[model samples]
Target: MTSNTAMIPSFTPSMNPSTKGTDHGVEDGVTGEKLLFFNYHEYSVKNYRLIGENTEDFHEQALIITHFPNFHVPRDSNTFEGTRIVRISRYFKGVGVFVPQFSPYLPGTEPAAIFGDDDTNAKFIVQGEYMGQFFGTSSYSPLSEYLTEKEFREIVEEINVQLRDAYNSWSLINLLLFVLDLLSFWIMSDLIHSLSKRKLDALFNFIDTRNKSLEKRGIKIISPRDSGFLSVCIVSTVKT
Candidate 1:
């Protein structure tokens, strides 16, 4: 059997009209309403341990059994679309064994029956109803007992601070990379435009020199738009 306890409080406020000739709720010659506030109430829960009888007669060389909840691994399109079920079991030889009493039993004898111990002595199982369907275990070594509320809060605050600092650093790095990408694009575009314009200017200069040589030999070339056909006319030179 397992039990869970949680405490929460609700706040409610009521307003009342102010009395005449009382300056307690008066502002700018107008009487303001008074509020009745109720404070929050707190409660605590007592912790208890369960002790049960051991009915199974097992040998002394039996391994200690610990049961954890079933877990599910999410599958994606890369793998499978369904969830995968998994269960885990941990075996301990000497450590994590809870012996209720010290008994001088033989190696083949049942420790639970010989020492009259309960089921808690040889097994540790967490109920799935209380701790959800999937629960994983983590170790905070050197600390045996559960942490206090203040200690847990402090650890959470420290983790949040570290995460914020990391986010800011990543933001700065992304900003720098974005700026460098823009600068590279602009420089490449300007270089290509300059090279294209230089080649265009060189081609125009060659065409202009050829036109001048033809004119010196008394040949006048007319454009297709002016002569209706691309044609060259021989000009008569009047030499005085």
Candidate 2:
């Protein structure tokens, strides 16, 4: 977090044959706001809104989690209460797809990190300090709740395993296509409904990760009076 943040997370092309320095996760002594990069393009959304037009209530109910302050996105217009979408805390270990719940949705061996001393239901990110914020929370991001290091690790482990399997299986690609396809063929039908809660969640999580990684390089210095101004950036996407 220096005055020039970009200079720190640089990918060197010269003098790299033997020299070394800290990686992108840490800050050199520059001075930017304590950054929690959210590259909206590298990650995908994993939640109910991906399916179709979410109910208006769903918009109000969804939550987003981040490692830093002032970073978030709104839900798509068609989601239900149980839907989820979120980013991982930088402190999370195991950086892959995962599901914390122990059920049919659960998988085994993903990327995860353990943070803090307590062992409550917390998840750690490999990138930043631990703060158990999660998406779709009513009382703020999920990380605000004090998750013990153990509980957080367990949740991250669960998510990483799932993400790893999905990547190995190329399921993230398939699932995105599936969502787009399902949304397309049946989308025009007013009766279209969500395929499964698990599927939706996976999509949200995927998109969020993409956001953090790919979009981190760019930040808009918005006018304070209208912090909500809209700007557009072109991006490629899965074919319909």
Candidate 3:
């Protein structure tokens, strides 16, 4: 069954949220297996640039699947609005296949297409949900300092492999996609990490206040609306 896991997170008008009209129409893709063993949460937020030559919509998306990124999650999730439903599968698992897993999504922007060749061995259908602005118009942290240049290059190459195979557009377009993903990842790694840190901090603060040692605490705020980014998650017991 389709689930909406986000309470309406307030849309900040000061941020001046705006929606990018769907270059394509909305679609409903169904008829596939679904594995939701681990509780997965995700958030999709849209960003807009007001300083560019012309104010334009900037989209981004983030996700955190449970278990491992190797497990297959059938295409059963629906797109909410501006978010494009995209799935990546390296190992294709079928319907009748049993897996114990879950994946959580994060806030991000959506691109025209993804280079997801390794995304195979399974089938999925993405349906559009929301179509307007997905996030507050203004707000973002500067790119964080993570992974050395060597590590960053490695990731860029890995992501490019998928894009080159999926979209049969052109070399120039492929190059452009790679550049965007690189910059986007730099920003997103920071975004997701900060949220995680905040959650952990809050949990610890709560424990100290209560004078109770923590046995376990798992809590994260993940937005599941706004189409600029994807929030689909899959849970499984394999490593990618």
Predicted model with the maximum TM-score: 2
Candidate order by TM-score, decreasing, is 2, 1, 3
Order the candidate numbers by lDDT, best to worst.
2, 3, 1
In candidate 2, what are the lDDT values of residues 89-128, reduced to their tens digit?
Answer: 2222123223222111111111111122222423321211
**Candidate 3 lDDT, tens digit per residue, 1-240?**
222321111222111233212222222134232222211132233443322224445545321211122122234532221122222211111211122111111111111111112233111112111222221111110000112234323432333233223323345644565566578976654444433234345533533442232112211112211211133221211111
lDDT of 1 at 99: 12
Error of 3 at 127 (Å): 32
Give stretches of model 2 more than 4 Å off. 1-67, 73-145, 170-240
Best candidate, lDDT: 2
Model 2 C-alpha lDDT versus the unseen true structure: 0.29
Residue 186, model 3: Cα distance from true site in angstroms = 42
lDDT of each: 0.23, 0.29, 0.25
What global local distance difference test value does model 3 have?
A: 0.25
Worst 10 residues of 1 by lDDT: 1-10
Give the C-alpha miss distance for residue 203 in model 1, angstroms. 62
